[model samples]
Target: MDEARWIQQARAGDVESFGRLVRAYQTAVYNLAYRMLGDRMEAEDAAQETFLRAFRHLDRYDPERPFRTWLLSIAAHHCIDRLRRQRPDLPLDPGYLGDEDPDPEAALIRKETRETVQRLLRHLPPTDRAVVVLYYWYGESLRGIAEALGLTVSAVKSRLHRARWRLAQGLEATDEV
Candidate 1:
C-alpha cells in the first residue's frame, strides 16, 4: 500500500493521500469505536472525530511507531472521552453478530454472551473499559496497550487485573438474578 509514501504525501497536504489512509483504516477505527461506545451511531461519530483529530495532528505523529497504533490511540482516547461525558447505558446491538452461525441454539447463546459482556463493560469506568477492550478484543500486548493509552505497563496490568475482577463480580451478580 506504500503507507509511508501516502503518509508523506498526506503530510504535504495531499487530501487524496489522506483519504486513502482513511479508507484503509476506516473499518478498524469504526470497530474499535463500536466496541468501546456500544452504539453504532456514537461509534460512527467517534470514528470521524478520531480521523479529524489525526489529520489535525499529523505533524505530531512519530514515524518510528506504527501508524495503526497511533491511529487507534486517537480512537481509544476519543471513545474514552465520549464515554466519560455521557456514560450511557445503551444496550449492545444484537445485529453485530453475523448470520454465519448455522446452529440457531449456538447463535442464541453467542448473542446472549455478547450482550452479557457488553452489559458488564458498561459498568466499568471509561479508562478501564478501554484497557479491557484493547487488551482482549484487540489482542494487544501490555506494552502496546500502555503505549496506546499513554499509561505505564504497570498501570495497564493493574487496570486489566481490576477490570477482570470487576467483570467477575458482575458475572456473579448476574448469575444470582
Candidate 2:
C-alpha cells in the first residue's frame, strides 16, 4: 500500500499499519540517531524515543509531506535536544562511533579518518554538525533537509557550506599537529 494509505490506516488505530511504518523506518532512524549520538546504547534510546514521539503525534502529521520526512524531523529534533541538554560539560568526540569494518588495515585507516573528522566536528557548533551529518551521511537533499530541520533551503545550503569549511579547516589544523 502507499504511504498515505498506510498512514490513514495507522491513524485509524490500525496497529499493524503503524508497525509496518516502524519496520520500514527503524533502520534509517537508528542510523541517524547513532551517527548523532555516537553510542549504540544512546542511539537505541534516541531511536525508541523518536518512534514514541512519532506515534504520539501521528495525528498531527500533515499528510501532504512524506511520512519518512516527518518521522526523521522528529528524530532529528530529539537528537538535537539531547545534545543540547548535554552541551555544558560534554564534548562531542566525532570518532566516538569508530569503524566496524573487519579488514585490519582498512579499519585502522577508517578509524583514523573518522577520529580526525570527529575531532573537527566536535569543535563545530552542534547546528553545523547536524547539517553536515544529515547532508553528507544521510544523503538528504536540501529540500529534505529543510523539511527535516524546519529551515529554509537557502539556510540549509549556507549552513552546509559553512560546516564543510569548518570541518576542512579543523582537519587542516589536525594535520599540522
Best by lDDT: 1
lDDT of 1 at 46: 95
Worst 10 residues of 2 by lDDT: 90-99
Whole-model Cα lDDT of every candidate shown, in order: 0.88, 0.80
lDDT per residue for candidate 2 within 60-132, as digits (tens), equals 9998887877887898888888878764455554454444788999988988876666577666665666777
Model 2 has an lDDT value of 0.80
Q: Judged by TM-score, which candidate is best?
A: 1
Worst 10 residues of 1 by lDDT: 90-99
lDDT per residue (tens digit) for residues 43-94 in model 1:
8999999999998899999999989989999999999988878737555666
Model 2 spans with C-alpha error above 4 angstroms: 88-102
- Kindly report which residue pairs in candidate 2 clash with one another: 94-118
* Residue 16 local lDDT, model 1: 95
